[model samples]
Target: MAEYMRLRQICLVAPQLAPVIADISAIMGLDVCYRDGNVAKYGLENALLPVDTILLEVVAPFQPGPGTAAGRFIEKTGGRGGYMAIFACEDPDARGAKANAMGVRTANVITHAPYHGVQLHPRDCRAAFIEFNHTDGSDDILGPYPPAGPDWQKSIRKDTTLSLTEVEMQSPEPEGLAAHWGRIIGIPADGPVVKLPNNTFRFVKGDSEIMSGLTFKVVDKAKVLEAAKARGCAVKGDEFLLSGVTFKLTA
Candidate 1:
């Protein structure tokens, strides 16, 4: 298999799936692709929406406590940090081994037939959980993403939100954090940004290290902002706060 990697999905955590999922769908004009029942085993419920080809997911723990990792993540960051950045790659095991060699422990390894994923410890990863996954015999960018459900692509709506353009990671030492993430993702940092095949990860200075914001290309910036305001989101300038991260709208 040829070596390649791209940001496949971005996960966000919320106290409840409600208004977060509803607000994002309403404001961005996105459709809910799937609500994975597989997560119930972990005492959680999730909903995934297609932001173009990339999946945008929000997970909330129904049983909120130390028993679940999602619950612990919410408490640790006070629900401020984004949960995970999942990448579709050629080899997940090789990537996990590389991260392990660098002292980053593997938090979990999930395998369900064709799909295989390796999640690195969020504490060691700093900003958020880093996951590398691959689906057997599916190398095409839009092909069989098990996590996003069987017909996720059918729900793709580009009328309002076109695509997820960038992910903004914030840390006190942005440059260092960028370099660290670059090493893990095997993409060398260009100053404070790691440019990927489909999207860009930009690190900026902040009080703590976390995935702070997401930038999106939309059809009409004003319309999106209006929808956000209607949904009771904290809208300011060309951005809004929903599910603990800023949604920056762009042309």
Candidate 2:
């Protein structure tokens, strides 16, 4: 199999899933694809929605405490931000090994039958958790993705939101953070941007290093913004704050 990697999923952390999930679905005109029971083992409850081919997931800690990673992240960020950037790759272990060599410690390794994933430490990764995963005999982008659940594609709705175009990673030292992420992902940084096949990661100046925003292509930008306002989102210009990240809509 030829080697390749792409942004497969973006996971956001929330204290509770209620309002966040509801607001996103209403504003973006998206449908919930799945709520993985597997996460319950880790004291988490999650919901995944398909944003074109990219899965958008929100996870909340049911058992909030220092023992739960999600709970700690919520307290650390004051309940504002994305959690992880999960990439679909040809070789997960190889990617983990490379990240480890760069002093990015491996946080966890998940293996369930045909699927395998490696999660790197968030502190070392800088902004968010970096995870590389692969499913055996499935190189096709739309093939059997175990995390998004079976028949996730059937729930895809593009009436309002067209596609996720860019992820905005913010840091005081934007260029340096971009270069670090580039090295981990094996993609050389182009100035302050890391351009992937389907999406781009734009590093920008901010108070702290974090996944701060997401840019989306929409069928009707104004309509989406109006929906966001109705859902009581804090709207400013072309963007609205939801699930702790700015959702920027473009026509």
* Candidate 2 lDDT tens digits, 47-145: 999999999999999977766999999888987778999999999999999999999999999988688999999999999999999998668878888
TM-score of each: 0.98, 0.98
Q: Which stretches of candidate 2 lie over 4 Å from their true place?
A: none
What is the TM-score of candidate 1? 0.98
Clashes of each: 0, 0
Instruction: Supply candidate 1's per-residue lDDT for 24.
Output: 90
lDDT of 1 by residue, 105-211 (tens): 99999999799999999989998999999998668878898899988889999899999999999999999999999999999999999999999999999999999
State the C-alpha lDDT per candidate: 0.93, 0.93
Cand. 2 Cα-lDDT: 0.93
